[model samples]
Structures are given as structure tokens and as C-alpha cells.
Target chain A: MAETVSAGASGGVLGGRRSRQEAAWGYLLIAPVMLGFAVFFLIALGASFYLSFNKWDMLTSPVFNGLDNYRDVWRDGEFREALVNTLAITIPHIVLRLICAMGLAMALNSNIRFRSFYRMLFFLPVLTMPVAIGTIWKWLYDPAFGPINSFLRRFGLPEPEWLSNPRTAIAAVVIVLLWSGVGYDMVIYLAGLQTIPREYYEAASLDGAGAWQRFRDVTLPLLTPTIFFLSVIGIIYSLQVFDLVYVMTRIDQTNQLPTVVYYIYEEGFRNFRMGYAISVAWVLLLMILVFTFIQFRLQRRWVNYV
Target chain B: MVPKFSTRVNRRSLLGAAGGASALALTGMLPKIGSAQDASAVEPYNGEEVTITYGFWDMAQEAAITAQLEAFKVHFPAITVEPQIVPWGDYWTKLQTSLSGGESFDVFWINSASLPVYASAGALLPIDAVVGDGGVDLANFAVPLVEMYGWEGVQYGIPRDFDTIALFYNKDIFDAAGVAYPDDTWTWETFRTVSEQLTDADAGIWGAGLQTSWQENYYNFIYQNGGQLLSEDLSTSVVDSPEASEAFVYLTGFFADELTPTIAIQQSNPVADTLFPAGNVAMLPGGSFRAGTYGQADANIDVAPLPQGKERATVTHGLANVIWSGGANPGAALELVKWLAGEEAETILGESGATVPAHAGLQQPWLDANPDMNLQVFIDALEYAHKVPDPVVGFEWQIKIQEVVIEGFAGNIPAEEIGAQAAAAANEVL
Candidate 1:
């Protein structure tokens, strides 16, 4: 009887040792990643945060300036203009992108001929490089020789100076912004649409609902999670628009459409005010954070999940 | 149960400690963290083989430059040359970032507008020592071109080429209009009348480009009309003067009368060369560098002295070769910069038919090479040439002034308002 008790105890000990080994393996697997984050990302964040407080021109030794950069950034009119431009361009861009992406995704979700080929065509813009697209679109936005104006002229429409005119410059940039982003968003929405059960649509149809009615009741509610996801992501991304403005507009063409990132670049790189640029970067971070918070707060009201 | 929990914790802690150790080592190894001091050290040139990277952007002149570099290698048999080309629009941004990050090339080209900003930041090595230490003979270069490379008596670069804007006219258009070819005696009024006589709006051809470019247009007019951009002390704006306004009006008057294309038209079709080459424009104020560019084009063009305004002045902009402060080889880099700015490189550049050298002794060779063209207009304009005034202590004020000029050309506001706007912007920087 004592031997039997001893055997049972040993068996228990062996099982415990095996479970402990498995747990240790799991922790070991994740340890490298955690360490990587600590070493690279955490340290970089701390360094930038410290630099944001101090005045450094990258060549001279850093001096502790104690929020002077922030003070100057607050008083800067160019920063304010950039902030306004960022919001002006981003809001319409996000709205149009969401609508266009959802509309295309819905259309693509249906049984259509050459669906794969259509997907490839739609995905072409996503695959194309941003710099190349920016250059090509810059030419297309040319008021005289561009196809945009030529197309408008065919319909007897007055061609507004697309890039050169301050009034229409932001709008023209938005067109390219939407054109570039909608493809990626549509592909994401298409993937989300595929996961949704077809039974929900059938059930809605059995209840005497029309296609639009079904979409409003079933498709939209199910797609809410994806739309919410894209909304938050698109807002975050559009707020940091540097390449679009840099390529579309000349650097010397000031006062019309300087995006927040471009403004930071001009301040930091061109103007050699690194401390001020860091402060501006911090402000951008705060703005993005607030926007992200608002999205998260609003998501509870609309976002649905199975 | 206690033994099991203790074993799991022990294993977790062990794994974590190992990761923590490795992580510390890895972070210590990142380029920015480890390479700052290493960047300052010059690598010894191995006798086996060596390569120096030369960064440039003008793809249009790549063939000529390649030939020049090939010739340079023949002189320095120990070194191999590699050319790195970035497009113009992205060149400054890329070069600036790389230099700041200590990833710069051994040698690259620099421009006057951006030199001060880089020099002030210590991003560039001051060349005064190198030039003073018998590495280069500064006396061979034009004094004005050499002065442009220095800030407050500290030299940072050597002149690569000096260019002054001159009037380039379509010979065909001049013949058709029955107008006398532009000569040294030509005045602003003569330029205006010839433009009006040559203009045919119905044919979609303008007599003059009247380009919105600040370098070619208003800045030249401002100086030639006896107005200055700043006070003699460089402390205040004089652009709001009556003389300045008169100059602005005279330039924009052609646009107002539809004799020259509006800023809107030029902005949309930025083919200053294309229009002139296609015989759509009778005259354009372009530089000697562009003379070579148009020579290769379909245009049967001839050069003439710029139309004399009140003062016979023209804007002179030049290119330079600046060595970065922390390049892998300051010695070799300095030698390369000096050679490129010296008679050797200038003669090769002239023979290659690229641009006129800023080296005084090298001018005749370039003029002789382009004997078919009126190359003397460039050399004569150098007498009236002026560099864009240096900016305020930290910022590049030229960019700000150009911004205002572009605003005027875009017709964002009235032409008269542009001067005041420009003055305010300049004061903001000052």
C-alpha cells in the first residue's frame, strides 16, 4: 500500500514537471519579442520624449529649455495653418474613402463576371508605389496638358487650376489621396464581407425585405466592425500626410496647402529648428491620440460583432 | 502544487533573464547607438582597391558627367568612382537626411541657396583650412564665386560653375517679326515692343515666356531698377520701395496686356524651353547651362545679352562641391572638391560642353568650345552678376522670398501686395 502511494506521488511529480516545462517554453518564445520592444522601441520613445523637451540642433549639445519649444509651437501661425489643413484634407478624405471602399466592396461581393480580374484591377493602385503615383498624378493634375482638364473640357466644364490654385489645391490632393487609399480599404472590406454568413441575408429576404433594406439591416450591422476599424486607421494615417503634399506642390509654394507633416519637415529640416519640430510632432501625436480616443468612444454605439 | 508553481516561475525567470541579457547587447549594436563615434573615424584606403561614391542628380547631364568622372579616374588610378543619382525633387531632402544621419557620400554637389543652412549647422566641413593649406589655389577662381562659398569669413565650399541669366531668342521668330536681334543696346522698352510685335494670341504662340520664375524675372528687375532686396546692412526690407514696385509693375504689365502668358498658363505648361524651342516664344531669360540643354533640342536658338533694365544687372547663381564634416575621407574629399573646382575639371567640363566654369582662366576655353553660340553674353553678364543675399542666422530666407514670388505669380494676391508680403515674411525670419 505504501509502494502504491509512492508511485502515485511520482506520477504527479512527473506531470507537474512536464506542465512546467511547457509553460517555460511558451514564455521563452515570447521573451525575445518583449526584449526587442524594450531595447529598441522603448528606448527610442524615451530619447525622443527627452529631446522634445530640450533644444538641440543635432550638431550642438542639447540644452534643457523647459517647454520653450512647446510655447513657440503654440504661437506659430504656420503650425496653426498646417493643423487646419490637416483636418480639412483628412476629414473629407476619410469620409470619401469609407464610402467608396464600402460601395466597391459591396459591388464586388456579389456574383459578377471576371471577379478576380476586377479585383486585380482594383488592387493595382495599392500595388503601385506612392512616389510614382504622386508624380504621375502631379502631371495628370496639370491644368493644360493633363487628361483631367482634357476630360473636363470635353464636357464644356471650366477647368480650375488643379495644383497651382490655392482654392482647389487641397481638393485636387484629396482626389489622389482617396484614389490611392480606397483600393486597400476595399480589399480589407471585401475580406470582411466574405466572412459574413449568407444566412443572415436569406433570413432578411424571407422577412420580405428588399436588397437595400437587407443591406441596412443585415450587411451594415455586420460590416460595422470593419468600418469602425478602417475609420480609426484611416484617420490616423491621413493625419500624417507628407509625401502627397511634398510631391504634389512645390516647396516654395507656401501658404496654400501645407499639411502638418510637411510643416514639421519645413520647420525641422528646412528651417533647422529641431526642437520646434519635436514639439510639433508631439502636438500631432496628441491630436492623433484624441482622434483615436473619439473613435474608440464612438465605436461602442455602432460597432457590432457576432 | 507548490513545487509545480515554483518550477514554472524558476523556468520563466531564467528565460526572461537570458532574453534581457541578449536584448541589452542587441540594443547596444544599433547603428545610431553604436556608430556616432565610428562615423568620425577615417578608414584607411586599402592598396588592393578603393571606391569613392559621387552623388549627383541631373540625369540630363549624366553622360557628360560620366565622361568627366572617367577622366578624373585616369588621374587618380588608385581610386574607383561610383556615381549615385537621385532625382532633383527628392535630391535635397535625401541628401539633407543622409548627411544629418552620417550616411553621406564621399563627394556631392551643393547649391548657393542651401549652402548657408548646411554650413551654419556644421553639417559641412569648412574648406578654408583645406584651401589655405595649399590644397587649392583660390586665386584661379572668380573672387565673387569664391566669396559665395564662405559665411562670415569661414569658407565651406568651392565653386563648381557660375551661371548668369541671359536672353535666349528664337532666330526664326526674330526673322518672321522683322525685328532687330537683341544686342547690348537693347533696353526694357525695346524688349516690351518686340514681345508685342511677335505675339499672336490667335495662333497660341506668345512672343515672350515672361516666366513666373523669380530667378529670371522680378529679382532681376528689382535690382536693375535701382532697388535692393535688403538694406546695405542686410537688416531691413527695401523691397517695398517705389523703384521695386515700378519694376514689379513693368514685369507684370506684359501679363496684364496678354502679351505674355499669365502665371496660370505658365504654371500649367512649365515648358520654358519647349515653348522657346517650338518657336512659340520669341525670347526667354535663361542661363548658360540651359544653352547646352537647348543645343541638343530641336530649337534653332541663339543667345543674346539680357535686355538692359535701369542698371544692367542680372542674377548670378552658382553650383559648388561641399564636403560633409564627417565624411570617411576629409583629405580625399577635399582633394576631389579642389580638383573639380580647379582648371583641370573646368577645362574638362568646358570640353564636355556642359557649363561655363567659375574659374576665370577657364572661361575662354568654354567660350571657344561653344563658338557657334553667343557664349560671351554669359561672360559679360558675370560683370553684373549678384548672388542671392544670405539668409537670416538660421533659416534660408531665399526660400521665403521665393515663396512670396510664387504667390504673386499664382495671382493669389495683387502683384503690388507681393512686395509687402515678402517684406513681412523676411522680417519674420530676421
Candidate 2:
């Protein structure tokens, strides 16, 4: 018995030979994916990193021009404008998305009629193609012919040109971003909500807590981890917005509806400044890293794994 | 996706066209074909069974292009040709990535705007073989069009077709408004006054839909106003002149007075295939290529001379077939390029009514394709049409000009400040 106990402890849960053979097969099965990752991701990452230092138009051979591309990015007024626009989008999107998702998750988590249908309805946009989304919304916001403007006109309200006006374009984009993005956050929040024990709510109720009080004391504290995860990911992804902007409102990269990725695209492909675009991409990566680091540092104060 | 109206590329000006003196001088310097026995033959097809890819935009022209290729098959049966048609918006993006990755079509359509940039970058294969004995004659095509494809005396492309800008007006609207059709008699004041007379805002109709394109609208006006976009040397922007400022202010009055659709409405609804055909606008200053689509629309449309400012001027641009330097079958590609530019293929292209063939004397068929419309106005305008002035760097500066021009059209920039701002913006990019 003592020998068997020692062998079990030494071999983990499986027999030694069986485990070794399984491990070997597991590695063999995963080798192709690993090779793909190394070739496509790792190698490309290194090449792009090296390219960030060189002056290349992708038509001719790269010439090593250290720090010049980076210096150009630092002074790029378009990039600064793109950053401001991205933040303008990211902050409001994150806040509104969290609130809307939490509200949806809570409503769906209760004994609501047709709960599954409502949940699926909200999540459908998440599954739809961004290009399709942009195309539909472009028509929807069409000032002359769109249903939205028609509805506003019928109500005798002012109808601002949604995608064309610089001031209102970002607001329209955020509404879309929230509509397409909130469902994903809601799904995550639903998982978080379920994890919070009913015992907490019951205990709160016994302590003479009202619905709002119970939600404040019990539901809010427990959902911090989910909120933190969503925010960090949301900022990183939203900062790189290109598809919706490119499809819906990409009028002129220098003036109207310029975003960071769009700026990179204009600089690299359109402007034929591949090296400078790579430098911009690296700056974006560093920004994401700093943002994530700050979020992680700030997480300790609010996030509760318990 | 909103279909782009300016498919007729801004052949923005071609090289060797600064003046008549340079043109004559270049005529002498053009590489001689038959004089040298050492000159290579263009037909380099071996008995090898191989395939070559030909990429282009404009699916509307596929049938004609295909018919030409089928004719190419009668000569070289061993060569299998594949046609890749990417949309205009994605064509350049795909071209860049594919060329960089060493996987691109053997031959593709190129324009003056991109030809210089690609040639300078060494991305284009020099078609010297096709410029020599037993090949097409350089003198057979228009001098400016031919010069548009040559870089440092090495030819890189063959002119496929040409387009000139003109006024496409709804005859029904003109008749309804009891206004005369746009003709050579009209000037800037006439255009504006007629626009004001034609506009019926209560019916949600604007007089015109000025496309927010530098080539289609502003370039014509700027040039017609005797305003040069660039100096004679093509080194600096000259749009800040009083003539250009006046023209800029004149064009904006149409927009400000609601004679034309606002930039916002045009963004979602283009003037060419959408609003103009739907009878929401009275007139459109568009490229001649728009006739193919407009002819199919249920409207009485006709073309007339673009009302001149100081001179009867319009911007003419052309597309050329060029071989990619990285193509696997250069011999096959060259053979296709030479054959495509030949009279036989041009006849087929013109007969199909896809566009006006660049070959001399083959434009009659395209003209007859739309007999109702005065398509002759396009060929006639060629006399006064200026090539899009392409700098050695590229036409990317045009984008900068457009960014400022769009705001100017939106009535955001003050009239006097708009021209100077556009000049400064273009100079910054240049």
C-alpha cells in the first residue's frame, strides 16, 4: 500500500509509461500549430520589428534608417488626432457597454419572458460581419433616404448628418460599437453573475436589504473581475478600430474619419511608407502594454477573485 | 458599398507634355524601333505550356477584355491566360501586398498617377522589346499617352484607353426647367445661373451633384480658370493664384446656395450612378466613361462641352497595360501587352462600348455605341484636355489637395483662404 501510494504520488494520476506515450502524442498532435505560430507570428513579428528601423516602400529593398521612422511618428499630427479619436471612442464605449451589458445580464438572469430569445437577439450582432454591419448602418444613417433620418423627420426633430459630420460621426460609430460589442460583454457578465452565490443575496435580504441594496452590496463587488477583464480587452481592441471606420465613414484619412489603424493603413499602403507604419504599430503596442499594466496595477484595489 | 463614380482614372497629366517644344523634342528622342537590327523582337513565346495572370479593375469591361483575350488565344494557343478582377478600392492595396510578397499578376492596368511611382520603385518590367522592330509603333498612339508610360527612355506600359471629363446633363430636367442644355456658350456664370434656375428644393431636387473628386470636378475648373495645379517644372503647387481662388469661390457658391447636393448627401449617395440617374440632380460634370452606365438609366441624358472659364479645358486620363517585374512569365505577359495594344484588340474593345480605345481612329465605334448622347464631345474635348499632371513621386499629393478641397466645398474654408490652404496642403505632401 505504501509503495502504491508513493508510485501514485510520483507518477501523478496516470501510469508512467502511458503518461509518457500520451505526452509524446500530445506534442506530436500540437506540433503543426506550434510550427505555424513560430513561422507566421514569431517570425513575422521579428521581421516587422526589424522593418520598423528601416526605410522601405515594399517596392524596393529596405534601407536601414534608424530612429527616423520613430521620430516621424512622434511628430505626426494625424497620429495624435487618431489617438484622440480612438480614446473618444474607447472611453464612452467601455462605460456604456459595461452598464448596458450589466443591465441586460441582470434582466436576462431573472425570470424574464423569452430570456433565451432576448439573449440570442442581443448576441446576434456579435456574430454578424463588421463589413455587413457598416454597410447596413451607412444606409440607415443616410440623411435623405435612411429610415433613421426619416423617423427623425417624421417626429419633427432635427436630423444631423450622421456619418458625414465630423462631430456626429464618432457618436454614430460609438452607438454601433456599443450595439455590436455589448452582447459580448453581456455574455461575460452573465457568466460572472451566475458565479455569485444566491446565498449572498439571501443573506443580504435577511439583513433587511432592499433590491438596490442587495445589488450594491452583493452583485457589484463580485463582478469587478469581469468588469476589469472586459475594460482591458475593450480598450486594446477598440483602440485598433479599422473595419467599421474603413467601411462606413472612411472619407479622407487626413481629414475626415481618421482612426489609428486607418492612419497606419494610409501611411503604409496608401502613402507607401511601410517603415513609418511599422513604427506607428509598435507605438500602438507599447500604448496597449502601458494601458494593460495600469489596469493590472489598479485591479488589486477593486478586483476580487473570491 | 457605395460604388465609386470616378472609375475613369484621373490620367492626371502625362509626362512629356509640359509644352509643344518638349513634345517635339521628345518625338526625336523616342527610342527608334526599326533603325537598329540589334533591337529585340516583341514576340518571345516559346512552345512551353504556361499560364499568365492579367489583373484589372472594371468588371463592366470584362466581356470585351475577354473577347480580346480569346482573340489572343487564336495566335498563342499554348498560353493559358487567367483574368483577376479586383474592385477599384481594393486593387491598389492588393497590388502593393502581392508585389511585395513576390506573388502578383503578370500584367495589370496602370495609370499615370501610379506608373511613375512604380517605375521609380522598379516594380514595373520595361517593355523595350515591345517598343522595337516587329512590335507596336510608339508613334501610332498619342504622344502624351505614350510618354505617360515611359520612364528614363524605357517604356513600361501600353495605353489601353483614354477618358476626358465633360458635363453630363439630364435633358428632361433642362426641358422641364425651360433652360437651354449646357453648350459651348455657357460659362461659369451661365452654369451657376442655370443651376439656380434648375434647383427645386421643395421637390428635394438639387440643380447639380458636384462629385467630391479632385479629378472629376475641381481639376477641370482649376485648369479652365487658367490655374495650374503645379508649376511648369512640376516641382511646386500653384493653386494659390487669383484665378484658382476665383474658381474655388465660384464652385462653392453652388454648394452654399443649395444648387448642388451637400457633401453629406453625396457621401452616401454618389452623383454618377445613383442620384444623377434617379433624377434628383439636373447636371453632373463627370468623366466620359459614365456614359456606359448612364445610357442604361431610364432618363434622357446627354453630354455637352464643360463650360470653360478662361479656356475650354478638361482633365484627360488614360489606363495602360503594364507587366509586373516579379511575374513568372514575362514573355507571355509581353506578348499579351503588345497584342492588347494592337489595332485588332482595340477594335474589339471599342466595339464593346467599354471605353474609348487609345488607338488612333478606333474611337468611332465607342462614339456610335451611345448615338443619342453627343459622345463626340469627349473626343472633341481631347483638343483642349490636359493630362493629369503627375509628379515623379506620385499622385498621393492629390489626396492632400482633396482633403482641403472637400472642406472648401463644404463651405468650411473661407473662399480666399481655401486656395492658399489647398496650395499649402499640397506643397506639404509634395
Candidate 3:
């Protein structure tokens, strides 16, 4: 009996050692990714945070400047303009995108002919690069020689200057962003629509419900989770809009379409105010964080996880 | 629990191996520092096989610059020069990051607009000692450009090439309108009258493409009208002065009168450059650097002196070759800069007709490269050329001024009001 107890204790020690070895191997397998995250993301993020409180011109060593950069960001007229423009573009973009995407997804999700072909067609814009899309759309909105203007002239209608006019420039940019982004959102919604069991609709029909009534009672609730997901992602993406705005507008016209990220770029790279740009970038981060938090809080009222 | 008799030594060895592997991977990814050679001890052409990198922005000039580099090899056979071409959009950002990171090129191209920023930061090596030791004559370059690259009695750069604006006209449109060809004797009134005659609204052709740009179009007018973009001391903005308002009125009148394409139309369509070559515009004031592209286009084009406003004035800007302060090989870099700014490289650059070399007497070759156009007009305009403003906060002020001026041209506000606003905004930055 004494020999057997000693043997059992040795066995338990061996098992513990084996499990610990497994844990080490698991960590080893993930080491590359962890290292990459530390070096590229974590280190850079920390540096940016540190630099926000200093004065740097990107050519010399940074000098400690306390909250001067933050103060400058608040006082800058261009930064205020950028903030207002960003909100104007992002809010409408999310609402219009959700509506248009849901409509397209509903049509495509129905028992229609050539559904895959239609899906491919609708998803084509998402595959094209943003720069290419922006460039092509810029030409399309050209006031004098664009096809849109030509069509307007054919109809004997006055063609308003779309991009050059400050009053219409932001609207034109929103149109381009919507054109490029709606495809991705529609694909997501279509995926969501397919997950709804056919029995739910059939039962609603058997109960003498009309099409709109069935959609309101069944499809809408089922799609709320997807809508919630997209809204969160869309808000974050739209707030950081840069490449499209940069490609579409010149500095003179940027007031109409300026975004916080683009302003950060102009300050850091063009104006050589690296520290100030980082400070503005931190403000953008805080704004996005607060917005995302509010979204999470609001989702409880409307989002249906089931 | 039943079969826990495995070897404990094996697990210990495996953990050790994993830790070692991670450490190895991380060490590979960390940035290596203090690896550069001690360049101070190395004399010029001491039979050392030193490799130095040269960074420039223009891809179109690569072939000509490559040829120049090959010629440079003949003088310093042991040294190898690697020419890196960063596109214009990303050049400054990359240069800034690399310089701050201590991995910058040995030598790079700098511009008048960027001179003060880099020079003041001590990121550029002052080349006065090198110029003096080599007995390189600064007088060989255009005086304005030499003065442009200088800051606080220290010359930081050697001018590689210069550009001045001139009138580029479509000969076919001129003949069709029956307007006399523009010449040196033409005044502002003559230009206005000819532009009016050349305008054909029914045909959708404009007399000229009047862009809202400050450098290529309006700055010349401002200087000609005795209005300075900034005070002589570079301490204040004087764009609100009456003389500047007159210049603004003259420039914006083209759009207001519909003689040129509306600001909206020009903003959408090809502005002056494409409009002129596409035959949509009869005349355009463009920089000499555009000569190559304009020469290649399928159009009967010619250049003349810019039509005089109150006086004959043009804005001149140029690229300068400077040595990086962080370079590992200052001696070799200085040698390369001197060779590039010398007569041979300038001759090669001029012969290619890529740009007007800043070397004073070598411009004739650039003119001869394109005999079909009056390229000499650009050279002559240099006599009265005003250096584009190069204040410490130049890029910021320039962008602000452009914004207000574009608003004026778009007719959102009156020209005088725009001028005053622009001056106020610029002065705030200054």
C-alpha cells in the first residue's frame, strides 16, 4: 500500500508537468503575432501618446510642451471645420447606407432569377480600390465635361457645379462614399436575411398576415442584430475617412469635405507639426471612443441578439 | 491521471526551446542602430568602396539623372551612388521620417518651400565649407536661387535647376481668332483685348485658362502691380494693399467676364495645362518645367514672355541639392553634391530638356533642345523674377492664402475682401 501511494504521487507530478508543457507550447505558437503586436501596434501607440504632450517638427528631437498642443487643437479654425464636416458626412452616410443596403439585400434575398449574378454586380464597387473609385467619380461629377452634366444639359436642366461649389462639395463626396461602401453593407445584410428560417414567413402567411406585416413582425426583428453590427462598424469607419477625401478635394475645397484624419495628415506631414497632429489624433480617438460607447448603450433599446 | 508517467525532463527542455525561439525572433525584428561607418575619417576618393544613396522625387527625370550619375562615376570610380526615386506625394513624408529616424539618404533634393524647415531643424549640413574648399562658384547659379537656399548667412543647398513662368499659347487657336501672336512688347491691355477676341463661347473654347493658383498665375501679377506677398523683411503680410487688390481684380476678371472658363468649369475639367494642349484654351501661363510634357502633346504650341501687368515680373522657384546631416559619408556626399551642381551635370540636365538648369549660361542648351517654342522667353523673364515667398511658416501661409484667393475667384466674396482676409490669415501664421 505504501509503494502504491508513492507511485500515485509521482504520477500526479508527471501530469502536472505535461500540462504545463502544453501551455508553454501554446504560448510559443502565438509568439510571432504577440511580438508583431507589441512592436508595430503597441509601441507605436505608446509613442504617439507620449509625443502628444511635446513639440516636434519631425526633423528634430521633441521638446516637452505640456498641454500647448491640445490647446492649439481646440483653437484651430481648420480643426473645427474638419470636425463639423466629419460629423456631417458620417451621420448621413450611416443612415443612407443602412437603408439602401437593406433595400438591395431584400431584393436580392428574394427568390429572384440570377441572384448570384445580381450579387456579383452589386458587389463590384466594393472590389475596386477607393483611389480608383474616387478618381473616376471625380471625372463623372465634372461640371463641364462629365457625363452627368452632359445628361443634365440634354434634359434642358441647369447643371450645378457639383464639386467645386462649396455648398455642394460635401454632398458630392457623400455620394461617392455611399456608392463605394453600400455594396459591402448590402452583402452583410443579405447574409443576415438568409439566416431567417422560411417557416417563420410561412407561419406568418398562414395566420393571414400581409407581406409588409410579415416583414415588420419577422424579418425586421431578425435583421436588427445585423443592423446593430453594421452601425457600430460603419460609424468607426466613417469617422476616419481620409483616402477618398484626399483624392477628391484640393486644399482650397477641403473645408467642405475635411475629415479629422485628413487634417491630422496635413498637420503632421504637410505642416511639420508632428506633436500637434498627434494631439489632434488623440482627440479623434477620444471622440470615436465616446461615440462607440454611446452606440453600445443605445443598442440595448433596439438590438435583438436573438 | 492514470497515465501520468511521462518524462518531466522533456517538458522542461521544450519550454526552454520555446523561450529561446521567441527571443531570437524578437531580436531579429528590433531596429539596428549605430551601424553606420565613421565618415569623418574618410577623405574624398581614398580608394574606399563607399556606397551612398541619393533621394529625389521626380520619376520623369530619372533617366537624365541616371545618365548624370553614370558621368559622376567617372570622377569617383570607387564610390557607388544609389538613386532612390520617391514619388512626389510621399517624398516629404518619407524623407522626414527617415531623417528623424537617423536612416536618411546621404544626399537629397530640397525645394525653396521646404528650405527653411529643414535648415532651421539642423537636419541639413551647411555646405559653405565644402563650397569654399572646392572653390565652386555660387555665382554660376541664378542669384535669386542661390539666395533662396541661404538662411541666416549659411548656404545650405546648391541649386540644381530653376523654373520661371511664361505664356504658353495654342498657335492654331491664335490663327483662328485672327489675334496677333503674343510677344515681349505685349502689355496687360493687349493681353486682355486678345483674350476677348480669342474667346469663342459657341465653340466651347475659352480665351485662356485662368487658374486660382498663386505661383504660376497670380503671384506674378501681384509683384508686377507693386504688391508684395509679404513685406521685404518677411515679417508681415501686405496682400491687403490696394496694389494687390488691383492684381486680384485683373486675375479674377477672366472668370467674372466668362472670357475664361468659370472657376467651377476649370475645377472639373482639365485646368490650364490640359485645356491648352487639348485646344480648349488659346493661352495659358505655365512654368518652364511643364515644357517637356507640353512639347510631347499633339498641338501647335509656343511660349512667349508673360504679358506685363504694371511691370514685367515672374515668380521663380527651383530645386536644390543638399547633403543630409545624418549621412554616414559627409565627404563623399559633399563630393556628389558638388559634382551634381557643377557644369557637367547641368549641361546634361539642360541637354535632356527635362528642366531649365540653374547654371547661368547653360540655359541656351535647354532653349536649343526645343527649337519649336520660344523657350528663351523663360530665360529672359529671370531678369525680373521674384523669388516665391520662403518664410519660416511658408507652407502654412501659402495654403491659407490660396484658400481665400480661390474663394475670391469662385465669386463667393469680392476680390478686395478676399485679399484682406487672406492677408489677415497669412499674418496670423507669420
lDDT of 2 at A112: 86
Can you write out model 1's per-residue Cα lDDT over A169-283, one digit (the tens) per residue? 8898899988888989999999889988989888889999998899899888899989999999999999998887777765334535788998888777667676778888998
Q: Please report how far candidate 3 places residue A33 from its true position, in Å.
A: 0.9
Ranking by DockQ: 3, 2, 1
Record all residue pairs in model 1 with backbone atoms less than 3 Å apart, i.e. clashing. Answer: none
DockQ of each: 0.25, 0.27, 0.30
Per-residue lDDT of B177-249 in model 2, one digit per residue for the tens?
A: 7888888898988888888899998887788778887778888999999988899888888888998888889
Clashes counted in candidate 3 amount to 0
> What TM-scores does chain A show, candidate by candidate in order?
0.88, 0.91, 0.92
Q: What share of the true interface contacts does candidate 2 keep?
A: 0.37
Q: State which candidate has the highest DockQ.
A: 3
Better of 2 and 3 by TM-score: 3
Better of 2 and 3 by lDDT: 2
Q: State which candidate, 1 or 3, has the greater TM-score.
A: 3
User: Model 3 misses residue A148 by how many Å?
Assistant: 1.1
- Kindly provide the TM-score of model 3 when superposed on the true structure, using C-alpha atoms: 0.92
lDDT of 1 at B103: 74
